[model samples]
Target: MDHAVVIGASMSGLLAAAALHRLFGRVTVLDRDTLPTVDAHRRGVAQSRHAHGLLAKGREVIDELLPGLSAELVAQGAIRGDLQRDARHIHGGHRLARGDSGLSGLLASRPLLEGQIRRRVSALPGVRVLADRIATGLLAQDGRVTGVRPADGEPIPADLVVDAGGRGSRTPFWLGELGYEPPREERVVIDVRYGTREFRRRPGDLDGDLVVIIAPTPEHPRGGVALALEDERWIVTMAGYGEGPGLALTEFADYAATLPVLDLHHLIRNAEPVGEPRSYRNPAGVRRCYERLSRFPEGLLVIGDAVCAFNPLYGQGMTVAALEAKVLLEAELRPQAFFRRIAKIVDAPWDITVGGDLKMPGVEGDPTPRMRMVNAYLERFHAAAAHDPELVLRFLRVTNLYDPPPSLMSPAALLKVLRGGAPRAVPVPA
Candidate 1:
């Protein structure tokens, strides 16, 4: 019977296990941290407490993997609402024109989402979770991975190995020890920092709308705020660019009071803090050119942040991981060729994320002329989205990874931008 071993019991790891469980007879998930009995924050995921949203495509992927998950989340007190109708979006100090695309999503804590997915994955036939086990290195033969060795002792043999370990993955070192060159890496760095605080939603909080206040970076030092998760709770995060310090507890309320968008600020003013603000800083935007590696080990693959970790502000990591899991399911039938297929599938999100990150003034990377043109168009598209609801929907569709970036440059979309006038103000419902 075929057995698969996945390192790191993260959302990406759990999803990898789910994908492998469908193809292999048995799947073992290994994690260095002790798995929590409840949906609570752990050391493994430092960003768990921060605000996270499931884009329309991500919601669809999760629903496909675990049927009724969206509804289940709602049953568990998560909010479900139309993306445009209920969402308050701001770009470049202007509120985006609301659209009626009916693209709705689930709002839940990262811990909650991870817990649900873990529960569902654990219930899969022949899948088991092994916590507090650290993967030290790969056991290989003839230059191909066959299993993994735990830090304590003994090797866990498997027909396939997947590294879903997050940004700090040791896959590159393990591959090098096996006499294979590491994949080419492309990195873009933006000095971004964030401080997040959760609040208990008061009556009439949000005014029945999901709050999303965003400001562009490079030019604008301060970032944005998003109110998500439980219906009665809000996770508000304040971010800053360059070397700017993130918001402090004493300053968070004051900072929120100044956003160009009033809805988020209003909600913050009326809401009561549920927890202390947590701060985090991210400087690396990485893309591993694993697909370009000519001698990648057979029966071994890397997914999620192990492969490419984007800026958290983009909120693309979880969605891209889910999309990658879906791609893995489709390619599992041909394990030998699966990595190549998965590599191609990963390109879409990588482009969207890395491309966007490169836009920051101080970020360093190679942006081909084509990429520059693409970014140029997107800038106008974003500006246009502030006025045109139809254009905004299309932009959301592409930004959410439901469609390719090229889709934003389609003839129809281009014409919309060419003919679309400057951004128009949208009046808030009183």
Candidate 2:
């Protein structure tokens, strides 16, 4: 392709630009926000103030696309830790046993992570990052996208166009305007809300642990995560399903104390807050079934949250976007084939995200029999993981996208679960 224009300059857009740079003569990425020159938040991404966990697979793929990127993040103050060893995880109302799982995870505020990747991608041979430009619509001829029409400027022409805009993307509406059928969509209302604050990190916080994740359960619908980010600070995010954590500092700390585990609360109780607390509300998880669209425009494709926006709790969004960029690097630029490929990439994480949400009584979804069976097995698995470090490794591997869900049902894994700890009396919401 002579030129490929990608809309949005966020993490997904930058990755798409990097991938297209390898195949196209010139790759341009456009975003409405005048992106920051430093590790600072932009008005475009309010969620950047919240916690962001770069799963292991995501870190690996991003580093591959922009070599030595992980080291760059860590050197800039991002924390790198073994997923199981340096972190504490509480799920299914039980604290999972910690061990060296060898899966490496990266933790940095969303702004820093996105800023570093944007810096590296902008340095690519054929990549360009254009800021403060709003993509109003796509320009098309002969049922193929030909360029992008910005809000206030002349149309920027391109041989190919990719939509990497996050949840707010307007690609479907653009498709409808072009006389193409909009992709079918699947949505599960989660009503997730978040409260986050940054705190000064000391030497012995959480007894030297780098990360702590306390997952919500049926009985207690609240969850929390604290990560040691760059700049010697800790970013803590507390969340819940319906009535989530409040934005007030007192409310945030009080909500943390309600979690099933006290590690998150303990870390924040004495730590001094660095800034005003921030909050975000995600009402639902959405997936546009682009792969099922019988017809799509040539010279156009969609990636990232434009295609699927999962529940943030699973920390799957960035990893899924990075995987799609990798697929784009290798696949031919056929829209149908491309969507089909990315659909498979979205399946695992989508399932994991929705599955976790559906476990709560307040989330609206009809669980399939298989879902029920899997959830039941997972409850047992989580209980076993508390006493068996091997089960913890297996579960972490799956959650980190390193292993398939079915791997947990393997004979060896089943043996470990069967012979491990007995299930405790887990409370169920009546």
Candidate 3:
């Protein structure tokens, strides 16, 4: 390919450019929002200021795609902690036993992670990043995408155009304009709201735990996570499935007090608040079934949130995008073949996210018999994980995308879960 143009300077887009820089003569990445020069949040990404976790699989993939990236992040103040040992997971109202699972996650804000990756990808040869450029429409000829028309600039031609425009991507509309059918969409309404705040980090705040997650259970619909970020700060987010907590400081802290575990509440209660809280709401988990399309234009492709935008609560979006970018590295970049390949990548995480959401009431979905069985087993697994470090490792491995979900159903894992302890109440400070 002589010149390839990618829409939206997102994580997926940047990674796609990394994969294409070696194949194409020049790659141009365009975004509507002016890209940030510092580790500051941009206007485009709604969750930019929120806490972000780069799962173990995501970290490994990005590291391989851009050499020495993770190390640079840590050196720049990102926290690297063993997934099992340094993090406390309170799920099914059980604090999972901690052990060194050999899986490490890089904890940083979204701005830091995206900014670092953006810098590295921009430095690659023949890769140019252009900000404040809006892709108004697609330019197609002879059933193939020839280029993109920018709102404020002249049309730029290309051999291929990749849309990483995220959840609000206009590819469907563009396809419809070209006399083609749009892909069918599958959506699960979650109505999840997030109230996030930053706080001054103090030594021994979490008692050496670098991250704490209070996952909502069937009995409790509220969830919260506090992660240690760079600059000696902690970004804490309190979320709810339907009616989330208020973003005001007092209300946010009050909601945290209602969590099954008091650790998150105590830490934020004692620490000095860094700034006013910010809020975000995700109405649903949407997946555009582009792979199901009978016909697609050549010289065009879609990746990342443009294809599937999951519930941000699971923290699977970035990881899955990385995996999709890895697929592009090996595929021929044909729209049909590329979409088909990424569908396989989307299946697992989609199931995981949707399955977990269905466990809560009011989330609209008819669970399969298998989903019900797996969810029931997971409750038991979480309860058991509190007593068995091996069980914790098994579950974390699956969630991290290092192992298949079936691994959790193995006879050995089943036996371990069967002999585990019951869920107990987490003690709160008086």
Rank candidates by TM-score, best first: 2, 3, 1
Q: Candidate 3 — worst ten consecutive residues by lDDT sum?
A: 421-430
Give candidate 3 regions above 4 Å deviation: 421-430
TM-score of the candidate numbered 2? Answer: 0.97
Q: For residues 189-274, what per-residue lDDT tens digits would candidate 3 score against the true structure?
A: 99998889999999878888899988887789899999999999999998999888887777878999998888888887778889
Model 2, residue 177: displacement in angstroms? 1.4
Residue-level lDDT of model 2, residues 148-263, one tens digit each, is 99999899999999998898999999999999999999999999998888999999888889999999998999998999988889999988998788777777788888999889
Best-performing candidate as measured by lDDT? 3
What's the TM-score of every candidate structure? 0.92, 0.97, 0.96
RMSD of each: 4.5, 2.7, 4.3
Between the candidate structures 1 and 3, which one is better when assessed by lDDT? 3
**What is the RMSD, in Å, between candidate 2 and the native fold over all Cα?**
2.7
**Model 3, residue 368: displacement in angstroms?**
1.7
Query: Which candidate, 2 or 3, has the higher lDDT?
Result: 3
Off by over 4 Å in 2: 421-430
